[model samples]
Target: MRPATDLAAGRPAAPAPGPDLPLDGLLRRAAAVAPDRVAIRTPLGDTSYADLDAEVDTAAGALTAAVGRTGAVVGVVASLDVPFVVAYYGAVRAGHPVAVVNPLMGDDALVHALGTAEVAAVVAPPRVAERLELLRPRLPKLGGVITAERLPTGLLPPGERGPAADLDAVACIQFTSGTTGAPKAVRLTHRNLVANAAQIAAVHGLDGDSVTVNHLPLYHPMHLNSAVYAAATQVLCPDSAPTAAVTAANRHRATHLYSLPVRLAALAADPGLGELRLDTVRAVLSGGSALLPAQARALSDQFGVPVVQGYGLAETSPLTHCERPADPRPGSVGRPVPGTDCRVVDVAGRFALPTGERGEIQVRGPQLMAGYLHEDGPATDPDGWFSTGDIGYQEADGHLFLVDRLKDVFKHENWLVSPTEIEQVLIRHPAVLDCAVADHPDPSAGAVAHAFVVLAPDAGPLDGPNGPAAFVNGRLPYYQHIRHLDVVDRIPRSPNGKILRRTLREAAAAAPTDRPPGDPT
Candidate 1:
């Protein structure tokens, strides 16, 4: 492993708050300091910090009455709206670990997530509530389903608070995105959430004066917690159109713009992009997946602001590294955030590798999770280092560059082939709007790279000599060359914007041998 001194060389220090603060205390502190500040703005309405805090208190009281016990898990469907924010904080304030359920999940996936968490109660919007009503029989432990409309009625006394929770106790449970395998429930403590909030706010340079635009389908806790921790204002934009988010940012005079890589790529491709003016926006931030360097450069050049990205998983409070806004790097996720240590280890063994060598990324930090649900103890080694299962490399100065998921990498002729490496080259072609790469079985070579591409609207024939296949193959080595290429209207992605490689790989394996070929082998 890299020396401790080397890892900590230029990283910032931990936030001012100690590790003892409760998760709900983030809202309380923000409300106390700026009670009248506009905390959130949505198309429906606006909410002040004082009003939001009071609503959380009422919701907490109601949840206390509904759950009838402390420490029971509460499932909260995480939609990007004001009620979700209330229920999420309310559950934590009521001394319950809130299991954040993605509202877009299918019935079986939803049941699996809630069942695995053993959720005793759930707070959801009307749609999710209706679905939960049908699944309640499967969840015998579930005692109640509270809708957002009922959260403000205060079923119990308004001032009632649950028992004080320990800082190290599990405060939130987030299931993985399941892009690789079955989603696992990750347990994050109050300390982990709080520390990460502070770390994110510090890295993003958020303060009371900052305003942010969240243009996502589901509200991620990382963005919500960090905004509350910094007492910054948030404008929730539910519209999926890339231009709508930009318009919202301009309307709110937002200082930071947070979006997914998929959305940003769309924004980069939008013809109206050149006409939009992000006069007040300082930075455009993306996460959940790597934003293509070409897309990032397009946005940076158009808006005249830095486009930054970060890296983390559900196991690490969702944030470990964030690119510096002032000095953004095009293709790097930047160094580890304050109070975090990251190193690359050999994939087959626990031994650390030298700088610039591709290996599994392992992380150690205050923001790491306690463990996955049903696990015995913290999911780390004796020394507290957690293997991230991501293949990456770090520069001598500590900037991390992701190669691909370790499991997603396949071998061809005994040589490891990174799908992302091929995808990156494919996307650089002007005609290729988006793309995904997966391995197809081969008797002699073990596996060959198969690519699925979404072409630009005005692009011409793809099977010609100058097609994407020839374009990408010319830039790659023999083993990494694209063997099969298919054109699709869109690439399949999870709700959180991760490319569904498993799905694509399945399609590739089941494809007929008479399909179109890429380059003349």
Candidate 2:
């Protein structure tokens, strides 16, 4: 058996000091240290570190041979499966910068992502492969489409090239959905990904002995890279059912459970939750969106485990801060992880603000992305601070609180309004199942709050405007009040549970505004 150092092909002969290794380099070190230990556990089967490493080598070699060289951009249709993880690292090891495409994206959005990243090839599931096959003629630069289940099988020759990664090399391009325009690709370097993975491991207390149960609809690189970097075992839970999480955790004695806010909220509201016991679970981590304070509390009290939340964007390797298990906060996203600096800036994106002052949150860290793909947008300043378009504030103790998105905040007369704040207040109503708040343009006031709400099951219809509208109006200030209420069957949300405020705002602009029932102005 060769030492891990011997595997280094294009880089220095000796391993670099600290956790500066490229993304795939972390896998090599894990395989070398714990060859026979299990690295991934899926419903289909379990894969050991040694076998996983060998398979990655085979996949990388095959991809390189098919593409004819390194640095070929590949689009990976991310799914909640082991193959997604394998292909992601394999492509990186083969020196291809992968574009993590959301399989559920609409046709137009998918085309935009594939074209922007200039992907030479696409790897997708059987169903998605068929869709890509139909659109192959549209993508002129697309070399081919490979099914995730059928990743070419062949080992590289003894003299074939191996992972030749540099710190500045682009590892992956993450497409972030913008509120105003099409989704933009976030270009992250090997250094950014590797550093963020290490930071996640440190803050999450992930180690070789830790086992994580992932209950997400798609395979997120943040979870994959961080778990691999820590040499921790990952159990993939494909089902969204809340009870499925308990079964998987207890079956594997999992230490951590990772999921999105939507699923966590459902889990907290599950009627049969009290029947299940999660003795091995230590923490429930939520990301992608803010977890409702009530939902977090309900789950924590029911399961005897801390239900925590974290904050970050695609440009920051997807994880900058996470709540510590020992000191969990219900509403706050906790402080920044090691090596990350966070501060609030004024709305103009300049002049640092005082503590508790709401403004745009900017982060500077080794984990920040190199830049955005295709678009000539300024992702970071000369000082390396990336303005997260999100409106938030940091406490004197450093805990971060997210308010709203910069584009979503609107001016209502003399006051700036956050739709998120009104949405949170409305969801507290027992009859409201889900709701979204958007700015409704007005002639008198610059804008007024409009709410699109989904009522709870079997809930009776309320009087025209006096029901939820009056209920919410009575609780909020004049400028913050929801002037118009639209009853809808459902609220539009992105796949990851973020409210599509832009969609609602557009609808509000086109629809006629109804006068309040009581007509009190």
Candidate 3:
């Protein structure tokens, strides 16, 4: 095979992967590398590469028949089993845009997306089918609703025989948070996802020997591009992907696990680790939510695997900065992966700044999402550097340290504040359990710091308002300290456990504060 540089330099003898290189090609390459190896292991059973290939062919035939046209949107709302992968590849095989919808989303959000994106055919499991049925009256353009359990006994469309793909053809559509307003669909082309996969794979040394142990929900970016697409050997998709994760590792002899911090905390706290015979997976990757730096160090020593952090967002095809296993910076997302150029910039999107300066993060690479579905948004700049809306800075050594989400930062007595920094310090408190810090609007200052915390069971009767407020007030600078607080059973979280600060923000906007009329507090 010619070197990638050969293609980059436009040499006459160099071979371009070409616009025709499709998602199926990735599966085909995997087949070449390990034709008969075990590829997907679920609670039901294990599927080898040869079996997976056959399933792809059969499912493709079924998917082609179901869609039967060029301008069709295929939806997959099944559980995270091999069939979902089979159906996804099958849609790509049928040459149609596939939208991977969340099985957990409510009927209203689901209906809004379907209406806005104009889905033609939807394929879903029984549970998802129930929700889709609720919206059936509202969706006028919906051509067909098919269940994952059953395939139609009919012929595929003749037009389903896909010709060469245009690199810009929309392949997948993922949605952003609708909290600010209505959710927007992110358009990703075949080349967009494929190129991002190549960059992620190249940077991590992902190859035929890499066994990815996945438990993350399949809809997330880290789960898709970082774990599934970048994996070289196989992805073990458990029935209860999270609860079954440790078991799958032992069963499949997995070499890597890309998990969120909640999972990592559970694994670290597992009583089975010291007594039970466990699999010898080589690396444990933690991201999507904050992974406590202390947890990284402790898990490394206990489990005998280094836990590394990675960073990215959905718009950038998920991965841009990844930690290298050979030499790691545990708290930092190691560096920009090959083929990706990342930098920190001011809100105006000017020139790149020096390392260690907090600013909005931007990335330019082959893997960026094509654009927001048809609305033409400002997600990416003319230079191809997409604004991640995340705040962080690159270290002098090239490692990236994530500060916080841009939206998560708020004004605290005229100084810009990041909740992550305060939360980091707050978590270190003995009585404090899960902590979330946000800005509560104040009369004198635009907003003041507010905290909600969970206390450890052992800590007696001190989890309420004054308990955490007093602790933070003494430890932090005057402006940085939280002035008001509430005790909650737990922090509101996403299905994945990323802190739901927006929910807290919304509640703050509704509540009345007790502070004096002109006080910043």
Candidate 4:
């Protein structure tokens, strides 16, 4: 293992936990500190910390009765509702690791994730529970499907709580988005979750006085855990519309706005954006994917707040880097959070690269997962470094700039081409609303850049003399230029808003060879 000093210069060493708490301990601490504070505010109703904590206890008892075993894997269809929050913490409180199942997943993906996690029981919304019942035959190990609505009705005496002292025990199982490949279940321990919650809270400057607006389709545990750890108020905005989220944030006096890049892009392009007022918003945070710098600048310019982006994978408890809310760099995801170390390594994974040199980004941090589910060992090197499979570079001041996915970067002849580089330039074109780039197979150049673009509602003809292809090509080197451009209605993305590049790549490869570049389909 390399010594701590051998890592980045300004990076701090991981902090020693004075008294590590279990995953449920965060909620307990919050409720104890501020019992009457509104921990969660939803359009349905507001849940105070005291009420939320008490509800979690009741749910824990119900889960204990349903599973009837310690260390069982309990699946929770993670929806953006109070029931999901209750069931998630309740499962962990009842001595079971909660497997977070995305409510929007297809039947095959849903079965695969739950089955792979060895889920013995599930807590889900009524609709999702019904769906799970239909798939019960395929999931042999699943013993019960309890609707979240029925959690309070099921009466049972509370069993002994989970081993709260065992911080190293698995607390949650999060599935990867599988944009590049099959989704794998990532095992996060209690320590990993708790530490990351603290890291996120500190980096994002959350405290008891803070109010966060979760403008997402699903209730991400990172937002939930961090808010609970900081004893801050979280407002769940079920409405997917950006304007509605802004209204909710204003209504609740939100200090932080958490959203996906896709939605933020829409918000930036919304003609009504100028009419919205975010007087209390401290920062507009984009995650799950990169937000185009153009969109970020647009939002920042109009809203008068820093529109910052962050980077992380499910394996790292979903948070390792966040832009410092105070002094955010426009394009960089900022530096690693306290106690986290980030370095760029050569593509071959042999040697580390110097500052400002792009390579595979690797991270070493306490918040990293123990390993993937059913994996042999920890998903880290002998030195505790885990390859992030991302291409990025760190500035001398420690700000990290993402280039593109290592797996997504392809070669144009002898030179490497980054689709993100081309996409960034394409997005700058006034007519382009959104765009995605992929490698299209070529007879000579091994591969060339192909772009799929979504045009603005008011966009002029894109195939004219000064079109998107000509616009982007002029800005990029010959090897990195877009050789084929198709104007599509929308770019395919995952539920989390990550571009479905593999799908685009396949589409690009299968495209008719005779179609001319910059042709709108």
Candidate 5:
């Protein structure tokens, strides 16, 4: 590994163990431990732990007064800015559940989130605030929009609040990415967020001294809560450019680098990559989607730092398994963190499978959410195990390798076909830049694999006999072959970087066939 140095770094003090506290308590504890230390470093400025705590208190008073009561749901536009962070914890501190909304959502989707969440007030950016006004007629529960600058403050005296909040109360309502359908709100309690934050900190080996650079498009609660729980400093790199992110980490002597899989792949493919260095970065972490194993190895080899990935959903406080830095695995998402149990269940969803047997993955843990918002009850079974709806298998050594989503898998002539497995193989082709496979309806075969491919810019078109469909067919088994192919410029992806397979499925099903008779389809 390349040598690292810390210019203005000091060890962060560890948090003391106690009863399960609310998510906002993370900021308070960090303040108590290191009041003068820098808690957040943004491109514009830095905020000390003490100042951040005070701001939260101030913002809490403003938010509570604006909402007019406790327990009101506040919709927060989750921008990767300092204001959003203050409002997120502030609303929670005032005894209200915060629903984090994607700022990039369309007007219709944003209206849906606000109306479904039943938010009394919204803390949003200037642009999103205007959009909320346009959507206000559709959202009956929405009382008003509160800008970051206009929140009421100084109503509550400093250091005069009551005891730690009840752990069972819902702290935040996280919505799932609606790549396939409408988003569902996951009700997360103080206990759920706190437990997962601790679990993440422990597994990632975070200490007060650790400095993480966040380059994701939006602020994720997993990164926010974990950093606060460990009293670690976080540097926000707002730039989407891969080299810019690396430069920010190097500038701050950041110990951890968090990013999305799409950005990492671009970083690995950058021609100017050889000029940059990550001397202070300990590890590069990817999530939201699977990072290509080849890209992971390339980045690790070039930077002399491990490139690791993790697995989870909004329903599980977003973390269950993570690759270990010490003995990193290239393709696996690594073992489950402390206090989490993972098992593979057969297609029937009743029988547990042996190691290496592919099945639906299920998990039970303290980090599990309380329930879905406005739903009857939690999705978990009576024993607290929640089926993840993901098809994968566990290894003897405990690593998890995800094959594909249960809904995305299909059967061809009594043989199960994994779209992800085929996509992985297709991506290895010399001309293929990215690809997605979906089942196309057929008269005899029931369904056949169809591919949507994005070729490399310089790579010549493979329109002849040696195209992707033929190339992939030669490599994969008969059941896993790509029956049809369409070249596209780009693959549609959600804001968080997950491929929109549902979109591809519709396109593939609509395309007319041009092949000879008795082909795969």
Candidate 6:
């Protein structure tokens, strides 16, 4: 690993979205509409629309000179920095496909992504070239690698980036959901993003005036596809400031606050939350993981903001169903948004069953991904619908409630352990940040439940950090209790703040028992 100082020197920052709006029109317009207005706030500093957009032009100019051609594949190897924004849009506007790979990934995942996508050139953080050295023997297809820290020396001879890019044009390639092994590279076109944005907008009545507190990372579909992109386009009524989380609604006075189940639980539990002028926030939505019904009810009751649970996979372009404000159901994932179709099918997989039946949940919609990049797949049957792999039931009212993963639900002895059930109980404990339930082989019982917990940062562990066992045994019935524990220093999270379950599962499997989580204070 390299320090920030070792990376390439900084180039001029990129621009925010603006006029003649095409691929990156939002920042341009925001520049015209609110030049002095803060466009994005990070831990670093706030960026005004005008300043940000100008840097975007610089990045485009620099990237255009270096690449020498259109329709090329460009890989970016940087963290969530301001330059990532510039390079992302500059490449798209300049007519190149952008493939973003997590710097944190292992060798196999990286080599597969680059080779599978046929990436010709790479624009990465400094020292990224060194990282690519390992790829030489494996990835024969890869060509030149450019460091974002080093700006191209000169300007290009002037060429058009073509007509304004459409919602249907290729925007970016994001990897999600294959954490157990090879993660899938989801192809999100401009159209799918735009369509989903429109759905969110129409559903929520978003406009130019709205603001959303963006606590999530730029990688998740909720943050990247929905919150940031939608907000920039004024499609889903967007506003995002990174600093707003600590300030509460007291600072930005944001209209929407997007959070995961864990964050929402913490925020709602905060006594100071109600003191802020959050009157403008119409509703709060949670996704990436399931929220316990009790957690859902607690947030709604405390904030006076309806807590709606949303469900979808990275394969589905991130969101297919969200609870609308008008007809709110506390635990229901609400109904499908416009342009989406849903149904519950039986185990054999053919006939659509009645509403009350619990089976595999399937969805079909325009917002679905272009498909995973590496593996040969469209991931659906002859028809357009895709199976969610999750087992759930659709209520007579059309609301969807998740049961357990068809594969995740297991029997220990004769009694079945529903991970979702035990997780709900474990999460309610004040010390637990997030938990994952998996089954390990048990010679006596056939299979036993293994709970891997991530504790809150502020709470010192019963052993050290991530120590979940000491407090777990007395909390739940033995049949469903966690038999093993691993206290990691920190849980691995996605750019969007999602728990990387595949990583946790691998770590757990490698060392089923370590220092016992000693005890919980």
Which is the leading candidate under lDDT?
A: 1
lDDT of 2 by residue, 379-419 (tens): 78876778888898877667889999999999998898999
* Preferred candidate (TM-score higher): 4 or 6: 4
How many angstroms is residue 195 displaced in model 4 relative to the true structure, after the best TM-score fit?
0.3
Steric clashes per prediction: 0, 0, 1, 0, 1, 21
| Superposition TM-score, candidate 5 onto the true structure | 0.94
- Model 6 lDDT-worst window of ten: 1-10
User: Tens-digit lDDT track for model 5 on 420-442?
Assistant: 99999889888898888888887
How accurate locally, in lDDT, is each candidate? 0.88, 0.84, 0.69, 0.87, 0.84, 0.63
Off by over 4 Å in 2: 1-18, 153-159, 464-466, 514-521
Model 2 local distance difference test score: 0.84
- All candidates: TM-score: 0.94, 0.94, 0.88, 0.94, 0.94, 0.73
Colliding pairs, model 5: 62-152
Candidate 6, residues 1-521, lDDT tens digits: the string is 11121011112212212123344565555567767766565555676667766766666666666666776767776445556666776677676778877776677778888877777777777766788875767888777777776644233345534346766666677766454456667777766665665566555545556666555433333443343334442111122332245365445566666666656666656677556435567777677776667767766776677777678776665677878877778667877777677777775644566766666788877678777765585678787768887788777656788877766667789876677676666666566776766666666776666666677777554544344554555676778767665444566665445556556555555654432333322
TM-score of 1: 0.94
Residues 411-507, candidate 3, lDDT per residue (tens digit)? 7666888888888887777777788888888877788777777877776545354455666666777777776666779998765567878888887
Q: Model 1 over residues 290-375: C-alpha lDDT tens digits?
A: 88888899999999999999999999998999899987877999878888888887786667777788888888888899888997
Kindly report which residue stretches of model 4 are placed more than 4 angstroms away from their true locations once superposed.
Answer: 1-19, 153-160, 457-464, 513-521
Ranked by lDDT, the better of candidates 4 and 6 is 4
Weakest 10 consecutive residues of candidate 1 by summed lDDT: 1-10
